[model samples]
Target: MGGLEEWKVLGGEGDQAFPCLEKLSIQWCGKLKSIQVLFPALKELTLSGMGGLEEWIVAGGEGDQVFPCLEKLSIERCGKLKSILICGLSSLVEFGIEKCDELRYLSGEFHGFTSLQLLRIQDCEKLESIPSVQHCTTLVELNIRSCRELITIHGDFRELRSSLKKLVIGNCRLGALPSGLQCCTSLEELWIVSWGELIHINDLQELSSLRRLSINGCDKLISIDWLGLRQLRYLVKLTIMWCRSLSYFPEEDCMGSLTQLRELDIGGFSKELEAFPAGLVNSFQHPNLSGSLESLWIYGWDKLKSIPHQLQHLTALKGGGATIASDLESIGNEIAKKCGGLPLLAKVLGGTLHGKQAQEWHLILNSRLWDTEDGNKALRVLRLSFDYLSSPTLKKCFAYCSIFPKDFRIEREELIQLWMAE
Candidate 1:
C-alpha cells in the first residue's frame, strides 16, 4: 500500500469483507489520507510512515463495529495526522503512538478498554494531554516520554494502583510529578529520567511495593526526601546518575535501615562534590549493609582519586571496588582469552574474582577446565568460575539461575525470594 492515495471500501456496498483477516500492516503509504475499511477479525493493525494521512474516518451507522477484536494497534511517523476518530476499539490491549507530530489530543475515554494492559505514547511534540485512565483497572504499564507539550497526566491512580506494575516518565515538560502518582502502591518499577525542571522528589514513602527505582538525567534536582526512601523498605535496586545538581546525601544512620537493598549505583556527580557519600563509602561495615549489599557500581567520579578502603568489609559484595596487582596482567589476559571473547563470561569471571588474592587469579589461569577437551572453552571456564564461589548458599543461588533462559533479565529481589522459598 506504499504511496496509495485512498483505500476503497472492501468487498461490495453491503458485503462483510475480510471478516477473517487477523493482522494487517500498511507502511510508507505516503499519499493515503483516509482508511474506512472494516476489520472485524483483525487482532493487530500497524500504520507507519503515513506522510499525508489527515484522517481515519469511522463508518457510522446502526450496529456497525470496526476493529472489534483488535488487541494491539501501533501508529508511527504519521506526521500530518491531526486526529484519530475511529472507535469500537474496546478490545485494544496495547496501543502505541509515536512520532505523530500533528496529533494534539486523544478524542475518547480509554476507560472502555477493560482489557488494556500497556499504553505508550512518545515523540508527539504537539500532544498536550492524553485520555484519562482513571477507570482502566487492568492497565499494567504506562510509558509516556518525549512529549514536550504534555504538561500533566490527567486521572487518579487509585484504579491503577492494584494492577500497574511499571511506570516510566521521561523527557517531558512537566515541572513536577503528577499529583496522583503517590497512589500507585502496586507499581513495582518506576523510572524518572531526562527531566529538566524537577527540583525535588518527594512523597514516595507510600510506594512500599517498589522494588527497582531509578532517577537519572534530572539536571535541576537538588534533593530527595530521604525519609521517604527509608520507608520504601522493599526497594532492592536503586540507581541515581547524571543528576549534576543533586547535593544531598542520606545520613549515615539511614543505610543501616535499608535492610532489603541489594544493589546501589551512583555516578556522574558534579566535580564540586569531591568525594562519594560518606554514609555509603565510609560505613561499608554497617551491619545491615554488610549483610544485604551484593553489588555496587560507581563511575564518572572525575575528581575522586580512590575507592573507599572500608569497602573490603562487605562480604556479600560480588562486584564493587577491586585492586588487581600489576603482576597479574599476563595471567589476567590468559584468563580473558579462555573466556572466548564473550563479554558476559568475562564480566562474570571478573565479578567472581573481585577482592581475591593474586594466587587465586593464577589458580584460575592454570585450572584443569582450560585443559578439558570435552566442552567449549567458555563453558569450561564458566564452570571453573562457578566452582570458586566461597558460600554454599551462593553456589546454590547461581545453580538455581540455570532455570532461566539465556539473556533473561531476572529481577534480583524476585530471585532472592525464590531462593528463600527453596
Candidate 2:
C-alpha cells in the first residue's frame, strides 16, 4: 500500500513480504538468485545489474511460483539467466530482454500469450530463432535488433502479419524477408537496416497499407522496382541511403503515382556516379507531384555539375505553397555559377557555412579547391559568419556536427548529449 525504497538484503535469511506491492524492482542483489514467493499482487517486475543471479528458478517442483500477476517484465544485462520462465505470467502484455548472452532458448507456446501485445529482444547474441507466433494474435509490434545469430523469421508469417503494424529488423543476418510478409495488410511502417545479405525486396509492393518506408545500408541491392511502389497512395515518406550499387533514380515519371509523397531522400550514392539523372527535377513536377512534393535530398553525387532547369520549376512550387530543400552542399559553387547565384543555393550554403573557418568555409563552397577557379573570392565573403560562435562549448558542439553523415539534420538535444558525453 505504501512506497518502499532502498531495502538492502544482507543475506537470504529473512522472508521478505509485500502483499500490496504492484511494482517490484530488484537491483544489485549480488547473493539473490531465486526469488521466493512474495508480492502476490505485483503487476510489474524489473531485474537489473544482479550479477550473482544464475536462474529464475532453482529446480523443478513448481506450480505458479513467481510473479503470477505480473503484466510487464524487464530483464537487462543478467548474463547468467539461461531461460525465462513465462509459464505463470498469463497476464503479461509487454516483455523485454536485453544483453542476456547466456539465454539460448525461449520455451513455451505462443498460445499462452493471449494478452501479450509487444515483445522486444536485443543484444541476445546466442538467440537463433524467434519463438513461433502461431497463437499470439494480439501482438502489434515486434522489434528485433542486434541479434547477430538470428537468421530467419520462422513460422507462418501470414498468421502473425495481419496483427503486426510495425516490424523492424536491424543489424541481423536475414538474407530476405519472409515470403508471408505480403499477407500483412495492416502493416504501416517497415524499416530494414544493415542487413548484409539482403539483395532484393520485391514483395514490398503488396503492402498497400504501408505509409512510411525506409531502407539503409543494403549494400547488395542493385536495383529497385519503383513501379511496384506506385500502389501505395498513402505513403508520405520514402528514404533510401547507403545503397552502393544503386546508380540512377527511377524514370522521370516513375514516382508520379505517389500523390501523397511529401519527402524523398536518395543519398549515399556510390562515388562512381558522374551526375544526377537527366530528368530528376522534371519528375518532381509530374502530375502526381504538382503541389504535394515539399522536400527532397540528393547527396554524394560526386560529379554533379549543375541543377537541371526543372529544379527552377520546384522554386515556383515553393513560392506558391511547398517548401523545397536540398543537401547538395558539395556542389554549391557549381550550382551558384550555373544558376547565377540562385537564392536557394545561397540560403542552404549560408546555414551550412555558418560558424566555419575562412579556409574550411571556402572548402565547402568550392568543393574541389585544387580544381575550381571561380569561387575563391565568393568563399571569402562566406567566412564572415564564423565570428558568431565565440563560446568554447558551443564551438565544440558545432564541430561535432561533422561526425554525422551529410544531409543528416542534427537534433538540438542529441548534439548537447554528444557534447556532454565527451
Question: Which is the leading candidate under TM-score?
Answer: 1
lDDT (Cα atoms) of all candidates against the true structure: 0.77, 0.66
Candidate 1 stretches with Cα past 4 Å from truth are 56-64, 85-88, 302-306, 320-422
TM-score of 1: 0.71
- lDDT score of model 2? 0.66
Please give, for residues 1-422, the per-residue lDDT of candidate 2 as tens digits: 01322243355422255667897766656556655445567888877756665565413333234455778888877777777654535677888888888876776545567777888889988776676765777778888888887776666768766788888888877888765877888888888877777877776677888888888888877666666776778888888877777665665565667888887766665567666654455566676765677766555555556545555445324334332223434444554664345464466456655534346555655554334344653453344333445677766765798799864435678888888898
Instruction: In model 1, state the lDDT of residue 68.
Output: 73
Candidate 1, residue 114: Cα displacement in angstroms equals 1.4
TM-score of each: 0.71, 0.66
| lDDT tens per residue, model 1, 216-239 | 888888888777877888889988
* Clash number for each model: 0, 0
